[model samples]
Target: MSQINKKWYQGMFSNEDWWAAWLGLFFFGLGLLSIWGLDAVGWIAKPKTWEFSNLIHDFSWSKLLKVSSKNYHHLHPLASLFITYFVFLILTSIGAYFQKLNVKKYIIGFTVIFFLTWLTWIIGHEAHLSAANATVKGHNYYQEYNLSWGLQLGGGASFILALIIGLIIGNFFKGFANKIKEAAKPEWFIKAAIVLLGIKLGIMSMKAMGFTKELALAGAAAAFVAYLLFWPIVYFIGRKYFGLNRDSAAVLSSGISICGVSASIATAGAIKAKPVIPIAVSTLILVFAMFELIVLPPLYTNLAPNQPIVNGAAMGMTVKTDGADAAAGAILDQLMISKHLKKTGEHWEEDWILSAAILTKVWIDIFIGIWSFILAYVWIKKVDRGNIKEKIPLSEIWFRLPKFVMAYILVWLIYLGIMYFFPDIIGAAKSGAHIAQGPYRKLLFMLTFLSIGIITDFSKLKGMGKLAILYAVALFAVIAPIAYFVAYLFHHGMMPPVVAK
Candidate 1:
């Protein structure tokens, strides 16, 4: 029989895939069942209290100024978590050195690990353990997630660590693991991130973001207005000032108006827009993601300690990339954690601003996939400008679209269900009595990252390099400042608007 004639299931999965799928399902089922059983027992309520006698109960200048987030006594355990990621990274590096394990296996392993974690920590535990003690004391749950010892991914660190290991293997074995190259795929990471976000939301309250019905409506209006107004100006600057061509300009403008460069690059690529366009756009995103990830958290905390939502929303609007958007959110949360209830007392409502910021961005990301399709339609039809006729059928256009986006949309929809369907599932337990539910879009992101490293040649990413670098830098320049400005205008310099508070 011809390939197209094969059954859909057979066409998608080979025997090898079947075995992998079964094993994954088996383990995942066990984890979910175990967690649900715990919920059924209802035995894990927040302990009335944990005994921490050394607790200073203060957010002092000395406490905030220290290299760490903790006072001296609470320092030992906090150091261990950082050390664990550090050691885990080193082990991955050593394994890459001694073993010939493929990236696909590791990627699959990470996916499995993350899945079980989602079932256990998120769906299973309600992501409440870290905050269990504090929640009783009336602290917000964003602080809960951070303190929870799970659900924290920021700074591109894990991705960066993976890159280093991949690079080392690439140098020694030189394509030994080349065949397993799905690690660089951005779409897979995006999908996984969204799923986790949705699951995370299930356990948390959305009211904390101050996303009032009125504020949400107002944000939508401002968002569309900003897109219409600024997109053209951004396009002009790229075309006239930066000397970018039509394709490059489209990618830049899309990154600005819609998501960020990742969205820009993927959309640009799908339409067969110029390769240089995405390269420049991705480079710009990397630069700014780094800046916003590392710098903005501290800067915001220092400058206007109380103004995280304003700052975080601004970053999300401007930074563009979903990952960077979350990183900025984490920063805002951390800063809030460092702030105190009273100037002399412990910080209150820690992570509130950051969580709110992330939710705002999450809401914004819902539009990204839709907006990209619209732009692609606009480019192909109205902006064809030549031999490209406007006569293509809607079916043809639909076929031309990337299938991966369907995966993303499906994931997003599932998350929406988790969030709205049974908010109560999160409030109570996870067993059948309470009820519940929720990859790398990865082959592509691995390719994208390897493409960057190989092209960067593993050297310092200083100075201009190629189409990618210029595009990436331009993206960051456009995104970061705009975020700052927007946040300022909306919240008025961190004074805490009625809606935000």
Candidate 2:
């Protein structure tokens, strides 16, 4: 198989990575127009917290759904939702066409996925499942709903519901799963969402530059240390104990210890391993990532409720994929915030915990290119000395680099530029930025949860018993514990800011 050393702009138009950048940047640019007093993103629809009995008593579209911004409140809720659906369908279909996917299947699949996603999102926002019990600024959802009990999951309920619904189709309804398979691109969806998260980080910097900087630095430090510790240990175990060949061992090590599917593919390309090595390993990574996404959030929430930042950063290190890590972080963020609000009647702002996870994973994503380049050089020079005639090109780094991160950084810098250089328009900029980072980013996340579930098939692990065992043991026994320790070392005392009631 060919390594990823193609031309600099080879995948700019055809690759999902670049598509993520294009989609995210396009939305961000629209959001930037708000500084001119235009509300370009306000047409997007978002779910509102509502109770079932109240809605039954007086059913109204306004009770369940609303436009993202007040500027578009004049639009009917269903009209706003239709606009959201139509816009995304057109945008993603263009991406599918460029990427050479079957455009027909993609549109059909996306249509089904989109509405199903919204259905779960609306249901998950039912006050009994999602509303907080505590009064915040004189607004108490529990009292308003007259509920005796609640899950208080916040937006996490939607995420969980989406995953559950997707998994049901993926596992039980084989034919239907195949139909939507064309639109189930979890990595693409998550990468785009991460780009929108850049807006959140930018706004965060404006509010608490010191804390944001500390969190970013701590995440970087923890990620670096964990990477240093994770790879060699897993590689040694794969070789010494598992008796795997060098190629399989290296690919598996990168898959399990690094950033999952992308790391596996990069390492395979670096070592000139057969394409099947990474392909096989990626299946394992995706399946295992689903389990982590499902189990880790509530586990950490109950286990170390006080160590919010620590748990978040640890999740960033431990979870294998960007989608799973961010999803798990979002769930953890909601659970921790909701629990804390119930216990203390103080609301901690959202996204800080989730940011901890994404920042750490972003650092890891940034390093994968350098890591792969070094591995390629070492493999050619030290391990395969007979291949001296072949030279590893520097372009390999560029090819393997995660492209969405570039968009994320650019979006963040743009926000910062406006904050420092054009302070007067900050309010206008934030009006749109909030919608971009809030409802828009969350919609992408909801898609990611559903898509990830639709793609994962546990039965695929049947033949790879030994590899699966190694993955399970390494992930839980070694990686998880070490990752948590490194996260705690850097983020022990850090905490999310409390919102005044």
Candidate 3:
């Protein structure tokens, strides 16, 4: 009987969550058609690495373009890039239109952001800036310049570059930043990417079914235990130290404990907190999430070089926002993988570490929905006894549920089924799967990084420094250590499956 219950299906079409599903599945379906030898989605523009010196010395206009990996080699690189841009423009524009945003601004802004993202992508992959120690065994770039400072940052260097560029624009050119904020929807981009990630997981799961099961079960358990331990301690801090009201404490607790902005907003609504509480907390969470994004990857890599899965799962638990968390996980994935490959001469599988992070975050995202409902009921019946007659809509759970997760799960199940039932076509399926999971997914992630930087305005946290301080302290003092231990408890000794050379 509540308003939250009224639009259970609205997220299906009205929110970024469904848009991610629709967009992801559109390409996934194209990949699915590849079983019949059709490369329906192969024309998407994918970038390749080139040295800055080479690019400067002998750069042709064509140097920047490449066809989507091996699967879509038939397509022209330039055409693929344009076609990919057009598809994303239309899809994201539609989402903006329905969300009651300035559609015209979104399209133009997205265009600028898109090109800027590609520019950063190309620059990021410059051999000196992004290369690892030639993990694939073809080239030994490590020996090129004595391997002293080749960055060795991998693709993550580019992502960080994009984020830095966006941050510069966001902080220094605030007005211009606001104009493009309509298209700076990092959460939307990341969710869409997460859906595509499901395809990757499915393909990877097929390769090592036991590994997937162990990683997933461990992630779920870690998330569950982390949530149980996190909320109360954070709630106590907000109440005892910060002297926050119950609603504020609950929202802050969820923001820090659960999946960041989503949890903060969900808790606020459930507890009937003033909207400003969540809004303020969401801002704090976003800014701090960036802080975590920037700091956690290298920190975790140094702290636990051997425990790749643990570091990743810990990233999922430590970083608050989905965009920041996933982004951090991705950076950590690249960092740890590159480091391990260089040190051990073994190419540790790429997405498994990322999957550990995302899977844990997904579990937390799923749990937050149920947790919000329980909180609502408790608040109504126990805390506010006068409102005991009021029924909490079961729809709140549906509303809070992350829809991209649904898309991710669905894609994973469908792909896993294909692998199980029609094993013969898996090779064909893999061709399309690579396109879906690699180039397409990377595009979304690049966009996410840029957008996240664009929208994050650290100066806005000026008036709320105390809350920010509290969040930072709690994150470092309480959250990070506990999360690491819990993740290590379940995921220790878990080595990512190595890729075949």
lDDT of 1 at 453: 30
lDDT (C-alpha, whole model) for all candidates: 0.43, 0.92, 0.87
Model 3 regions more than 4 Å off: 1-7, 69-76, 135-137, 141-149
lDDT of 2 by residue, 151-239 (tens): 99888899999999999989988799999999999889999999999999999999988999999999999999999999999999999
Across residues 179-262, which tens digit of lDDT does each residue of candidate 1 receive? 344333323333333333333333333332333333344345445545555567677777876777788777777776566665
The residue pairs in collision within model 3 are none
272 in model 3: Cα distance from truth in Å? Answer: 1.2
Candidate with best lDDT: 2
Cα displacement (angstroms), candidate 1, residue 364, comes to 4.2
Full ranking by TM-score = 2, 3, 1
What is the lDDT, from 0 to 100, of the residue 473 in candidate 2? 94
Candidate 1 clash figure, as a count: 22
